[model samples]
Target: MSKLEIDFCGVKFRNPTVLASGVLGVTASSLKNVVKNGAGGVTTKSIWLKEHAGHKSPVMFGTDHYFMNAVGLSDAGIEKAEKETFPEYSKGGRPAPIIANIVAGKIADFGKLAERVSKLDPDIIEVNISCPNVEDELGKPFACSVVDAAAVTKLVRSKTKKPVIVKLSPNVSNIGEIAKACAGAGADGFCAINTVGPGMAIDINLRKSILSNRVGGLSGPAIKPVAVRCVYDIYKATGLPIIGTGGILTGEDAIEMMMAGARLVGMGTMVYYREVEGFGKVVSEMEEWCRKNGVKNVEEIVACIS
Candidate 1:
């Protein structure tokens, strides 16, 4: 465990592996299952201030090479999370940190929801300003603009004492600039390259768009290189710990991101690739890689890029 143990924003984790949001993180039981399967930390689905009715089904469609989803930030909402999910996740005072990933429709909603979700006593609060599916309300993902991104971070910062990590969108031209904006707004950390786009998959057979939303965020191995570059650029700009996400599938992929400056590596589409059990599989491979390389502390690799 020595190789896996690491400190992130003053919190301790049994390993560097974390469960990325929006992939089976809908409830306490779902997240608990992630922990049970061996993730060192877990992030809840991006919950909103109120129940959000998402886009119609066919909200997602994909191939083995990549994944596309327009989940529309659908969640059980903050009230239900506080009453049922958060309490259940923390019921036994578990040491593994639970980060409450929150989203909202308006600038004001960010602060309000952050305050409420922070009160649930999650170890950390993640502000999701990157979801591409919310453009109907937000015009575009907040993470796409420095001004909008900073505003959300500043507002959420004012509302919570817990560490606030801003999740960014890969659709932006320069995610590092957005990371800098969040850091300036007092973000304790950052999560990079939240799904890749507003892409469409057409069904030639049915003569229709594959997803109801027409376009969705692209994830999976297809985005790995881009996510790595985003993490590298952000580390250079902010020097803050990063929950590097996007297209991570193997222990090697996790190590690659760590070397690029991620203190914690997030696993999302990998769950789809390898199933929930992928958590343990990836962790074991990480340890095996460390043993082979004589790397005793995984943290030693963060920002080791030279």
Candidate 2:
């Protein structure tokens, strides 16, 4: 195996850098482009059981330090994914594994999406129960409650034979407790600390909110500290591997995340900063760091923090 290779819940990744859900994840060509540019794996945008329209344009904005978005989990549904995305991704022989990220407004819908997407057979299925932008339509996120989180986990787990990783939120009081609850309900693994804060930003000139939805989740360099903490807590609580996400923009940031107990690091806004080629750039930087630090296997750094 290459030094950068990792086995996350039985799925092998060429490297630990994966395309975070909702970036350029809408189509097969975009996801494959991410792999071609050196991402270890790709996750599709949140797929619903049926078509779901997202927020209007002006859904996102970014600054040097952070990005705020309220895309509202837009997706064309699983049928389109099965008919176009999965088949097209497979047509190219799948340079890297695909993780289908599914979201729903209710528990039963989560199960249905899970069952349907399972048939398409993406290498992994990520249960997105923690999105912060859909609260107006769906009430609070499932990740906010231990019982609800576990319920979603149990239902999704029953629906799919594939490894199920529950995406988590950072807005909770004790993220560890929630992680433990999901683990008890049969979650194979987790992707910790999705975006943070359903915060708002104003357009000073327009004297109005920037996002059409008024507020959105905060990501980019600002939330890395929270993501690291959440990953550490989840790892300590369950000893389960996590895909550490939020605010990672460089190789050093990825290493810090692994040291905080992530088996893989997911990047979203980094794409905005460095483009697709940033994946390869991050990987090269990681190799250089390992070489200079006398680290042989990159996995050796996973949870090295104590």
As for model 2, its CA RMSD to the true structure in angstroms is 1.0
What is the alpha-carbon lDDT for the whole of candidate 1? 0.89
| Candidate 1 per-residue lDDT over residues 1-306, each given as its tens digit | 446998888889999999999888888889999999999999998898888888899887668899999888887688889899988888888648998898887889999998888788888898898888778766887888999999999999999899999998878778788899899999999988798877788999999988888888899999999999999999998899999998899999999999999999998889878999999999999999888888888877778883
Top model by TM-score, which number?
2
- In order, the Cα lDDT scores of the candidates are 0.89, 0.93
Q: What is candidate 1's TM-score against the reference?
A: 0.98
On a 0 to 100 scale, what is the lDDT of residue 92 in model 1? 82
- Weakest 10 consecutive residues of candidate 2 by summed lDDT: 1-10
lDDT of 1 at 284: 95
Assess candidate 2 and give its lDDT: 0.93
| Candidate 2 lDDT over residue span 1-306, tens digit each | 229989998999989999999999989999999999999999999999899999986899889989999999899989899899999999948899899999999899999999999999899999999999999999999999999999999999998899999999999999999999999999999998888989999989999999998879999999999999999999999999899998888999999999999999999999889998999999988888888898889999999994
Which residue pairs come into collision in candidate 2? none
